[model samples]
Target: MNPVAVSIEDRVLALITEDELVSLTEALVAAGGENPGGTEEATVAVLEAFCLGAGLETLAEEAAPGRPNLTAVLRGGDRPGLLFLGHSDVVPAGEGWDRPPFEPYVRDGRLFGRGATDMKGGLAAVAVALKALKAAGVDLPGDITLACTVDEEDLGIGIRAYTRAHLGERFSGCVVAEPTDLGTVVGCRGDSYIDVTVHGRSAHSGRPADGLNAIDAAARIIALVREDHERLQQDQDALLGAGSWNVGLIEGGTGTSMVAGECRLSLDRRLMPDDNAARILESLRERIAEAGLERDGFAVSAAVTMEMPGFRTPEDHPLVADAVAALSDCGVASGIGGWTAACDGGFIARDFGVPTIVMGPGGLNDQAHQVNESVSIAELVAAARAYALLCLRHSSPA
Candidate 1:
């Protein structure tokens, strides 16, 4: 495939207007695709309708009931395609906001809403970028696919199921439009949810010495886990820094007068690309054993509830280079970076065997689920331009 002898950048920029981008983002923010009780159906409809109006082929498939993953494709070049991926779901809008969480509003040049900075804004930018490319009338070297998945905040069934269905498809590269504040994220830490249960005997308050206290055993386990967390800090990755763990929740003890029978602990552990949940759990169990928790009356068991793998793309990868160049073209000064929090890109990179980068508008490490989560309008426009340029630069055949 011969390269089209035209500068596709200017054409793409010209077609991606600020007004439409803001309007699209505002509408999406208003849709409230908050997870927990999903409403991705409505958000998917909005994105699919926008894609259809832009003369792109659109598909909406539910990862689960009412949780739809939306995809749009613009066939341009015949080379291996590029996928622009993002999530339609946002974390539930909790409390303490200047305005209503779902009521989209703009003030001081920032779009304030629940999904504004986290991803919905980025999703809109990618959609408009594709529309701009289509409107530019430039021949692309390969196809461009824009996918908005559901349930990214929770279990990530959206991307997992989508990848399971499209595993045979090949892409030269993928860019997850996760909020990077216009920077490119080359790697991220993975996450795991773990449960630790400590079992013991219950007895009356007067006979406390006769029965072992599960909460006491749990406290010992927590101390050992904290030691494990500190120990992991010594094994750090250059990009992701270091692995860490936190005991997020703990529950036990039925009454103040009786000895606690059982204790349950929920933990969140961050992993490097090379780490796995099984190994981490094994390490925790070892720690428990070292703490002398496995005895006649006291026993501890650890189970992994969820595990998401992490990934890192080398700086020389074509996908990363092209993204950096595109950001440069957009007059955005960006360098390769890493994300402390995991994202759906990890799934794409791990399962699909595609080099994936996290890049988008908004703050580099912006607070997404917090009260008054907002994104800069100017940054979003820049992100749109950057996405358009990246598609032309990376997806086109040399």
Candidate 2:
């Protein structure tokens, strides 16, 4: 802790220089930790090198094979600390870019690249903030840890493994630096991927009476799915609003001359905090059977392939209040909000038993996983200042 009490905001704001922020952000953006290719190895190396250069005690361990989670600890007093969390992985670049996605460059005050907005930029902001706090000679009462994990874009096993190993440890709080356009996020919707397959008998099209059309049977199931989604509109949460589901894919039919023998539909369901994925899946199965669609040469089956739980931190939690105050300290107008997409923070909230808040630099849902992705340079710098202030306020001795 500082010998004399002063404005933490001013100290933090003055410490993170503009040139350092831009260079760090660009380096992270250029890493290109695309998950579809595989979990990031190169990105982890870059983060490790940076931490070593900063003289922070760092650890690089594999959460999964070749998928590393890097943690840089700025040790302070012995007490519960704050964890600044972010992921190193990004979704694969599909197409459409004015320049190469991996070559990060700045133009018109925005940093452009594949992972610039979704999270790598946020990680860079956290890194710079921690370095600035050290350079300013500010003493902390508790440790400040920065964790950049892998495989968040896919199954989230990286965070899951890391949290599981560190379950016994206590953290004062955690801030998941997922882009929220500088807003503080307190809750997020859960998501599940369901595969529904409908079976039918095949017959020649010339003899329509003999054929049990699988496509026709699939139509009934589709109707029921749509109706269930509409009914789910009544199940709402204060921050997340109503639960929702969408049929993203449907495939059926062997040929134009034959009745389809099978149909498969892929569903994406978004659940509120209290919604149970197992119960929801079972309900879908029961509804299909109860509707008498299982007979008459029509059979339906559904399975959940991937799922991530939702989380909501109470409004009165100290973490939420602290985050709001931290943003104010940095001169950014921020309010508590909800994120519509599922993120790894859910695992820390549910499994690790830590109070978590999500905040970072860019428009989270708008610019992420989109063509020509970019992040505002100004927001990047401001986020670093906000994070530094948060540490000064929360991790300092009373």
Candidate 3:
């Protein structure tokens, strides 16, 4: 620790500079393009180089081959440190961009490219913030670590591996640099992906009565889910409200001439911060059984495929207060709110025993994963300044 008790200015710092911020964001967006379950190696390589080039102490651990999680640690002073979290992968750029998706460009004060808003841009912000804070000779109250993971857009294996490894560690606070458009999100809904499979005997459509009719059984499950959804509406939380359900996909039937033997329903269940995924699944199973799907030689099974836990911190908690204050200090208008969408930060808060908040720059609803995805240059810089200020204000001055 340098032991320099200094206040960060509202304006962009001269150390790392704004040009570097923009440049880094562009490089990250370009190298970070990944389809769901695809390689994040290219993006990880670029980030590792940036960390090493900045002379920050860094480590790269592979969550899987070609999927790496990075931790760039800036050793500070004392216990109960702060953790900065982010993901390196982005949804694939499918179609509709004024320019090439990987060819990052800035116009009208916005940086446009895939991953500009959803994340890659936020990753650059943390990298720039840590680099500038170190160069400015500010002493930290505790160790500040930036852990960027992979597969956030898909299975979330990166964060899962990370949390399991650090189970014994502790942190005072965590900041997930997801694109929240400068809002300090204190609570967020968790999410789970479920696969509901219904099995029955296949028979010729000409004599459909010979088969148990899997498609018909599956419909009953969907109906049960619909009723539960309405019940959720009756009970709501101020921050996270009630969890919602969506049956996104349905596949069944081998051919029109035959009765469907197997049908699968892909469901999305959003959870309140306090909801348990396992229990939720059990309830759904019970509903299916009580709905009587298994009555006439029909079997219905629901299994959880993927899970992202939700989290909530009190509004008056010091972490939330410090985050709001930091955003205000950076000349950004920000307030505490709840996110309808889920993020990797939930894992840190729930699993690491760290009170976490989600805050960053970029449009969550509008720009993230959209065509010509982009983030305001000013917002990007403000986020960098905010993270640095949060670290300073959160830790006791030396």
What is the C-alpha local distance difference test score of each model? 0.86, 0.84, 0.86
lDDT of 3 at 183: 95
Query: What lDDT does model 3 reach?
Result: 0.86
**Tens digit of per-residue lDDT, candidate 2, span 221-262:** 889888998998886666888778898899999899998889
Task: Residues 1-398, candidate 1: write the lDDT tens digits.
Answer: 23343455665688999899999999898888888777788888888888999989988888998788888999875687899889998888988988899899989999999999889899999999999988887687788999888888887789888898888877888898988888889998999899999899899988999888999999998888788888888977778988898999999989999999899999999889888999889978887887787755697778998788898999888888888888887788998989888988888888888898999887645457778999999989989988888877775333
lDDT of 3 by residue, 208-295 (tens): 9999789888888899899999999999888878899999999998998999999999999998888888999999998887877787
Candidate 3 lowest-lDDT run of ten = 3-12
Clashes of 2: 0
As a TM-score, model 2 comes out at 0.92
Candidates sorted by TM-score, best first: 3, 1, 2
> Would you give me the overall lDDT of model 2?
0.84
Candidate 3 residue pairs that clash: none
Alpha-carbon RMSD of each model? 2.2, 2.5, 2.4
Better of 2 and 3 by TM-score: 3
